[model samples]
Target chain A: MRATVLYAAGDVRIEEVPDPVLHEPTDAIVRVVRSCICGSDLWPYRHMKPDPHGRRMGHEFIGVVTETGADVGRPAVGDVVVAPFMYCDNTCEFCREGLHTSCRRGGGWGIGGVDGGQGEAVRAPLAEGTLVTLPVGADDPLIPSLLTLSDVFCTGHHAAVCARVRAGSAVAVVGDGAVGLCGVLAARRLGAEQIVLLGHHKERTDLGREFGATDVVTERGGEAVARVRELTGGDGVHSVLECVGLVDAFETSLAITRPGGAVARVGVPQYEQVPLGRAVFMANITVSGGVAPARAYIEELLPDVLEGRLEPGRVFDRTVDLDGVPGGYAAMNERRALKVMIVP
Target chain B: MRATVLYAAGDVRIEEVPDPVLHEPTDAIVRVVRSCICGSDLWPYRHMKPDPHGRRMGHEFIGVVTETGADVGRPAVGDVVVAPFMYCDNTCEFCREGLHTSCRRGGGWGIGGVDGGQGEAVRAPLAEGTLVTLPVGADDPLIPSLLTLSDVFCTGHHAAVCARVRAGSAVAVVGDGAVGLCGVLAARRLGAEQIVLLGHHKERTDLGREFGATDVVTERGGEAVARVRELTGGDGVHSVLECVGLVDAFETSLAITRPGGAVARVGVPQYEQVPLGRAVFMANITVSGGVAPARAYIEELLPDVLEGRLEPGRVFDRTVDLDGVPGGYAAMNERRALKVMIVP
Candidate 1:
C-alpha cells in the first residue's frame, strides 16, 4: 500500500508501505477513500516539533472498511465511514462527560501517540469507537463533506460548544483556516446573531461570510481586538473560538471575548505562556477547550451535513489524487490552499 | 471626628480627622458604628502594595446614616445600614449583570480610591446602591456579623456563586484566612456536600470545620492537590475558591478543580505571568470571579447573618475601640489576629 511518510523537514514522500491488518479483535482495516492535510501536521513538517524517525502523515479521513476484526459489531466491511481524528471508547467517564479527546485509553490516530491515516489502507483501533458509518455510497460526490466530518466540522462545532455560543450572542472566530471557517458555521447554527471572522486573506473572509460571518476583521492581535470591539459596541464578542495555536491568535481570542464570556481554544497549543490570572480575575473570562472531542459533536453535527443544511466541504479548496499527497502537503504549507483533499 | 489614619506602613494612628461631608450629590455621610480590618488592607499596611500615605484604613463596616446626600434615596438619615466595601450604581448594565465591582463609573472604596471607613463619619458614594438598610435596631449585638456583610461574607458568597457550587458538589477552598473561612460557609450555603479547607493554622482549621469544611488539607501546593484528589476519589473537587493572591495558591486552586469544574479566584492577582495553556485546556477547567462583587450578594446574604442563620463574624478573633484601631492593624499585620473589629 502506498502511504505518505515524512523523513525530515521538506522531505515528504509517497512510498510503498506494508498493508495494515487487524491486530486486535476490536480493530478494523479501512481502505482510505479520502484524506486531507491538517494544520497540526505543519508542526512536525516544519520542524517546529521534533521529527521522529519514520513518521506517517495525516489524521483526517473518510474511508471504506476493507475488513473488520471479529469483535467489530456495527461497521461492516465495504461500508463508507468518517472517522474522527482521535478514537475513543465512548464509554469512559470523560467520554460520557463529552471529553472524548481525553479518554483514558482511546488514543488512536495521527497524533504522535497514535497511528496515521494518509495511506491506501490503515488499521483502526477500537473500531466501534473510531468509525462513524456514513449514509453516502462509496462513489457518492459528498465524500469531501464526509471527509471534513473526520475533523474540521466536528472540531469547529466543539470549539463553539465549549465557548457556550447561544442565540442572539456575538462570536469572534480566530484563524481563517477550515476549522475557523467551520467555526463560523457552528456558531451560526448555535444561534449566534453576529459573527466576526479574523482573517488576513480575502478569499478566506469571503468563505467566512458564506458560513455566516457578518463582519470581517482583517487586523490581527490588539488591533484585531479593537476591530472586534468596534463591531460589538465596545463590549467585545460574547464568545470567541481560537483555532490558531499561535500566541497572537490566543491573545487576540482572549482580548476580543467580553468579560464573563468563554474563550474556547481548539488550537493545538504551541509553547506559549497563557495569562490565565489576568484573564480569569481581571476580565473574569472562562478559558477552556483543546483537542476538540470531535466524537462528541459528530452525532449531533453529522445530520446537518447529511441533510445539506451545511456546506463545510467548501473548506476543501483543492482536491488531488492519492499520488499527489506530497504536493497537497506542500500546497497547504505554502498557504496556496485552505485545505487539500486526497481522493484515493 | 476620630478616625484611623495610616501615615506609613505599620504607622497607624487614631487621630481626630475632620468629619466627612457630602463630596457629591451621590454621596452620603455615615457614622461608623463598627468597622473591621480586612486581609486586603494588610497588603498596604505590610507594604506589599504601595506604602500608605495619609489615608483611612478599613473598608468593611456596618454603620448608620447620620446625613443624606441630595440624590441619595432608599436609606434615610439614622437608618442602620450594611454597605459593601465598594460602592456601585446598581442601575448600570454591569451592575445589572451582577458585576458591581467593575461598574462603568469606577466604583470602589478604600485603597485610596474613595474615602474609606474606619472613621466616625465616612462619605459613601453611590449611596443608594452602596448602603443596604438593616431591619434591626442600630444597637443589635449582631453588629459583628452584619459588619462582615460589608465584605468577607458576601465576597465568600461571590466566590461560591462564581464557581457554580451546587448541592452535593465537592468544593475545595484555598487560603484559610477570613475570606477563605467564609468561603467554606458560602459553599455550605450553596449545599456543597464535601468541603476541603487548605489551611496551616489550627485555629483557622477549627473555624473552617465549624463553617462546614468536611476535611482539612494543611499541606500546600502539589501535596495539597494530591490530598484533595485522594479525598475526591482521584478526580479532584468540583469547585474551588482561591482567596490567596500568590503563585502557589493560584496553581493549587487550578490543580484541585476537576475537569469541567470551576475555580473561583477572588484573590487580588499580584502575579504577572499566569501560565495557562496546555494544562488548563487539557483539564477543561473554567476560571471565574474577581474582587467578589459583594454588593451583588449582600441583599441575599445579609438577612441570614442578621437572623443568625449564618455566622461569618466568627472569623473576627479580636475587637478594639476606635482609639485602639492602630493596635488592631499591628496585630493583624503581625499575623497575631485573623481579623479585628473597631467599634466607634
Candidate 2:
C-alpha cells in the first residue's frame, strides 16, 4: 500500500508500506478514497519536531471497506464509510452519554505512534462505532464533502451544541478558518437567526456568507467584541462558537457573549490563562465545548451534506492526488488553502 | 430614621438619616425588625473607600411594611416582608428570562450607594417584584430565620441552581462563611446526598454539619481536590459551590468539580482574573452562579426555613445592636463572627 509518512516536520513523502491487517476483532481495513489535511496538523508540520522515527500523516478519511474482522458487524466489504478522527467503543458509559471524544478506550488515529489515514489502505479499530457507512454507489463527487464529516463538520456541530445555540439565537463564530466556517453552517442549521463571522479574508468571508453568516466583523480581539455588540444591540451575542485555539479567539468569544449566554469553545486551547472571573462570572457566562465527538454528530450531519441542505464540504478549497500530499501540507501550513482533500 | 452608616474602614456608626419615603410609584417603606451584616460588607468595610457622603450598610433583612405608594400592590401596610439585596422590576425580558440580577430597569439595591437594609427603615423599589410578603405576623419569633431567607439563603440556593446540584449528587462547598454554610443547606435542599464542607474552622464545620454538610475537607487547594476526589470515588464532586472569592477558593472549586459538571460561584468576584483554559476545557467543566436573585427564591426557600426543614439562620453566630455595627464589621473581618444579625 502507498502511504504518506512524515519522517520529520515539513517532510511528508509517499512511500510503499505494508498493507494493514486486522489485529483486533473490532478492526477493519479500508481502501482510502478520500482524506484531508487538518488545521491541527499544522502544529507539527510548521515546527520542526525532532522525531527520529517516521510517523503516520493524517487522521480524517472517507474510504471503502476492503476487509473486516470477525467481530465487525455494521460495515461490510465494499461499503463506503466516513471514519471519525477518534475511535471509541460506543457501548461504554461515556460514549453512551455522547462524549465519545473522551472515550476510555478510544485513541486518535495518526497520533501518538498510531497508524494514520493518509494512505491507500488503512486499519480502523472499534469499526462499528467509528465508521458510518454511506449508501452503496454514492456519487464520488461528494467524497470530499463526506470526508470532512470525519472531523471539522462534526466539530463545528459540537461547538454549536456547546454554546447551546437555540432557535433564533444571535450567534458569533470566532475564527474564519475551515472549522469556523463550518461553525457558521452549524449555527445556521441550529436555527441561529443572526450569525456573525469574524475574519479578515474576503474569500473566507464570502464563504461565510454562503454558510449563513448574517454579519461580518473583520476586526480582531476587543474590536471584534465591539462589532458583535454593535450587531446585537449592545448586549453581545447570545451564543459564541470559538473554533480558533488561540488566546485572542477565546477572549474574543468571551468578550462578545452576553451575560447568561454561553461560549462554546471547540478550539484546542494552548497555554493561556482564560480570565474566568472578569469575563465569565461578572458576565454570568457558561463555557463548554471541547474535542468534538465526531462519531456522535456524523449520522445527523451526513444526510444534510448529501442533500445539499448544508455545504460543509465547500470548506475544502483545494484537492491533491496521492503523491501530492506534501504540497497539500505546505498549502495548508501557508494558509493558502482552508482545507486540502486528497484522493488516493 | 436611624441607619447603620459606614463612615470609614472599621467605623460603622448608628446615625440618624432622613426617613425613607416612597420615591417610586412601585415603592414601599419598611420598618426593619431584623437585619444582618453580610460577608460582602467586609469588602467595603475593610477597604473603606472615600465616601464623604456616607452610605447604609446591609442588604439582608425581614421587616414590616410601614408605608406603600399607591402603585405598590401586594405588600399592604403592616405586612411582614422579605426583600432581597437587589431590586428587580420582574416585568422586563431579563426578569422574564430569570436573569433578574440584570433587570431591564437597572434597579439593584444595597450595593455601593444603594439604600441598604441595616437601618431603622428602608425604601424598597419595584416593591411588587423585590419584596415577598411573609404569611407570619410582625412579632413572629421566626423573624431571624425569615431574615436569612432574604439574602444568604437565597444566594446559596442560586449557587445550587447554577451548579446543577441534583438528587444523590455529591456537592462540595468551598468556604465555611455564612453564605457558604447556607450553601450547604441549599445543597441539602437541592437533594445532594454527599455534601463536603471545605473549611478549617471547627465551629463553622459543626454549623455546616448542622446545615447538612455530610463530609468535611479542611485542606486547601490541591490537597482539598484530592480529598474531594477521594470522597467521590476519584471522579471529583458532581457539583461545587464557590462561596469564597479568593483565587485559591476559585481554583479549588474548578479542581474538585467532575467532568461535565458545574461549579456555582456566588462569591462576589471582587476584581480578579479567573484562569479558565486548561483546567476548565480539558476537564469539560461548566461554571455558573452569581448574586442570588433573592426576590426570585425568597418565596420558595423561605417556606422551608419557616417550616424548620432548613435552618440557614444558624449561620448568624453573633448578634449586635444598631450602634454595634462597627464591632460587627470588625468581628466578621477578623474572622471572629460567622455572621452578625443586627437589632435596630
What overall lDDT goes with each candidate model?
0.84, 0.84
lDDT of 2 by residue, B275-340 (tens): 777657766677778766676677678668778877777888888878888888888899999899
Candidate 2 segments exceeding 4 Å error = A5-18, A136-139, B111-113
The TM-scores, one per candidate, come to 0.94, 0.94
TM-score per model (chain B): 0.95, 0.96
RMSD of 2: 2.4
lDDT of 1 by residue, B271-335 (tens): 76666667777667777777777888888887788779999989999989988887888888777
Best by DockQ: 2
Report the CA-based lDDT of candidate 2 relative to the real structure.
0.84
Worst 10 residues of 1 chain A by lDDT: A107-116
